[model samples]
Target: MYPDYAKKPRNVRLGLCTNDFAPHGQYGRTYSCWPIIITPYNLPPSMCMSSKYMFLTMVIPGLSNPKHLIDVYLEPLIEELLQLWHHGRKACYFDWHRQFLPEHHPYRRNKKAFTKNRIENKVARPRLTGNQPLDRVANISLAVEMPLSLPDGYSSDHKWTKKTIFWDLSYWSTLLIQHNLDVMHIEKNVFDSIFNTIMDIKGKIKDNMNAHRNLKIIWNRPELELDERRPNIMPKVVYTLVKEQKRRVCEWIRGLKFPDGYASNLPRCVDMTELRMHGMKSHDWHVFMQKLIQIAFREMLPEHVWSALTKVSLLLQRICSTTVDVHKFHELENSVSIIMCNLEKIFPPAFIDSIEHLIVHLSYEARVGGPV
Candidate 1:
């Protein structure tokens, strides 16, 4: 890693002691001496008793010119095929051909730019008579070619630029070398079950909110009740995911299910004005928030889930509703909102306000939408 890319390994290790000429009465034998430079493969003199001569294997530059690299790496597979063919096993050869042949092989004709060998030089080129460094002109050229120079819109974000370069590199690499890593094969069964479940729900559920809300039901509902046409590779795995989804969905849905214009903790259907006058006196809003949260977690929630959520509300209030300082609160708000939105779809309109208002005040400093 420490070696410079420009330095050739052989030149660095051994230098020419003499040029093509020798003095009179002397044999012109140019001796090459090894330097004290030590690599991982190099052994020290103390480690071995015998004097040794080191030979460096030269890596021809064009061998890694993308095309040759692919051939060298796949040499084992080619050797196996040659051995099979030499044995006069025509059927084995045919099977090997069918097995290893790629459907979209790019090697039939080397038309791609990557297959062609080209010199990549890091040397400086004369562009203009200038006092400025080479980088300045390069930057100016880059800016001139940018999309913003035209009338059409230009995205100047660095992230998009990096993504485009990465994708192009990946495409070229895939063409040169088939990435044989079976990514989907590793998780194929689970992936297939999830994919099938999503396809099943895609058209059947009318609303996206409903589909999102019923993610658990879509996966975990007893196999006996699921549509037979829908394929499920692992019902048990699907069932486990469904249960987890249900719990998460229910948390957010609770807030949106709260009733509107219903007097909170009020006695005997009192008038709005009377309830407001008395409600503020008796109810501590923070305490009331605690009770509502506790009611949702009737069976006592873990410190991480419940306490983490409550602390988020406090942080949100303390930070004046800015998400930068309260990333966790933002996460909690989003998670809770998904559940609440789903619950709102099924809940009666009259019952949504009280619960929704409480969650809103906890997560955000903004006042409730309507009058107090």
Candidate 2:
């Protein structure tokens, strides 16, 4: 439960906000409402007394830093709090940074330096003469001139400032303490990157051939044998078969009926001729790779290729479940670790690190009921 001041109707105002384009062909629309009174008092007795928290205050669109829209959203709320009987000077920004950098890391150290300079020289510095509240908020604007010098391998170039209204020192009492990492997004991204690597998509290292050869050697069964007697297929022929297979698969997917209780949103069927692998979510990718691929193109693909795909698919399928036991998650981690170690070329060290990081957290999250 929040403080008594937070529950006060006079001290709070709430609205659900969204941006939408005009029906014709216009863009850049703005809409706001302060009419909705969404305090706990308006809710039913049972709902109001529920443990779950809800704060439907103000919403600001766009990702720009110095747009003044965020300031507009918070300014009135701050004023109301200030006017309240139990006004508190202390405020905190809860920053969820997915690409987490540790305290000792150079990037984090650089951010700390930037934060310190902004706080001491700008935010905390006394103003000469102006509206005190406006001046206080203006001090919160952090300059983005300083470029982050990262380690050699990092791909990003210094193009934009990292300043946000959330980092405004004047509004928040504690700067560093407020910033935290969202483990869910981090895990999602890590899983996506790993999946991309295995599929050899999105510029990831393509060692599918090596994986195929390794799989052939490991699974030296007669059923998984390469037909040496058959003549080599032409490149054009292979391409045509692949294209046709994709079209058929797309048709099948559209016709397929999902059973009740499927957790993920049903993937929309797209015309493969018009859109090549468009409208697919992360879960769709997993499903396609794990179940659809082999079923759709069973006879067309080579034994080695099929075997390699199956191996990766099975491994990923085991770990990518919506609900995984702690023991299963641990087993998945160990299995992935072994695979990464055994097939260095197929699963590059950097790619493997992403998988490992997510796997390490998966068990903890499972124990806690869900991802954070």
Candidate 3:
């Protein structure tokens, strides 16, 4: 690695990002395409993120994410980078573009990318910024699937997965801000969990038989524990909305209107009959979490529950603002922990996902890494 690379602004400083997206809506046949994009940090802020300048390095196509096996496809990219660093910079060492294509999809079969002639069956499966939930999840094997909380004997103890392929880059560890949490995405995940659980959307919310059974295993809230006499019936919880409340919340969102271009037509996202919101975009989630959340739930939930949710929303608004207040930032850094604990008491344990706990660390990152 060149020591002067940082001093020389012309040197390419790469930022790589990828996420699973369905080009043709979420329903019907399932399709996911992970677009691997690269951007040079040397460009001006205006052009840094411009699609014209960004490069689509690779596209991993399949029914689900590669998960741990992603490194196999990235080997070429790694070799190219290694050559550039160790053997001096040079472009176009190898022509391995087709390696990025999908080998076999759930809908159709195709030649394997790496082993060309070999036919392989489809492989399965599918962050917030800021903080780590030390007691993250129960012991789980990552190869099978993503870390899942066990309904029985669930433990918050931290469990880590294998190191990422990016670590193969020699200079990666030396970077001051090695990785930053994607705050916008974290906001959406948190909102989805909270909003869905509160509205009690079937199959979407975290509170269920698993969560109810989990209470008995953890031995925390005796009140929420499933009664031996009525194991089939779940006890009512404070965080959820009744049938009427869910109907009203959905109706309110359906009828509300916003100024042109200020936000999307959120009315369409609401399902009147189902009493739930669907198809909300990232920015729409941002608006709802940072602004509309408190007002929408003001009457639906209990005062204490509403107050806790409001604090969570307010924390996001403050953190996402154009500027961060030193005084408020410190207060936020300290206060998020208490708020998280309050939420733990109110919502089911299953509700405490990684993103939900990430609020505890946002203030720390904001202070250290500058404004988000």
Candidate with top lDDT is 3
**Candidate 3 vs. true structure, TM-score:** 0.56
Which residue runs does candidate 2 get wrong by more than 4 Å?
Answer: 1-241, 260-268, 281-283, 286-294, 320-326, 340-372
For model 2, state the Cα shift of residue 19 in Å: 29
lDDT of 1 by residue, 1-372 (tens): 635522322222221111122234344434222222112233344532223433322222221133434455344444433443343211111001111113333322222211122221222222222223232223332333443222211122211211122222434433322222221222222222222232223322122222223223322223223234544432232212243443443443333333554324333212222111122222323323333333433343434334433542343334333324455555544444433333232221221333233342333222111111
Q: Report the alpha-carbon TM-score of model 1 versus the true structure.
A: 0.17
Q: How far is candidate 2 from the true structure (C-alpha RMSD, Å)?
A: 21.6
Query: What are the runs in model 3 whose C-alpha is more than 4 Å off?
Result: 1-175
Query: Residue 21, candidate 1: how far off, in angstroms?
Result: 99
How far residue 34's Cα lies from its native spot in candidate 1, in Å, is 99
- 174 in model 1: Cα distance from truth in Å? 50
TM-score of each: 0.17, 0.33, 0.56
TM-score of 2: 0.33
lDDT of 2 by residue, 78-152 (tens): 554444434332221111111232233332333221222211112112212323333333423244542322222
Q: Write the per-residue lDDT of candidate 3 for residues 243-362, one digit (tens) a residue.
A: 998888888888788888778999989888788888889999999998899999999899999999999998888888788778888887767755765675567656776667666668
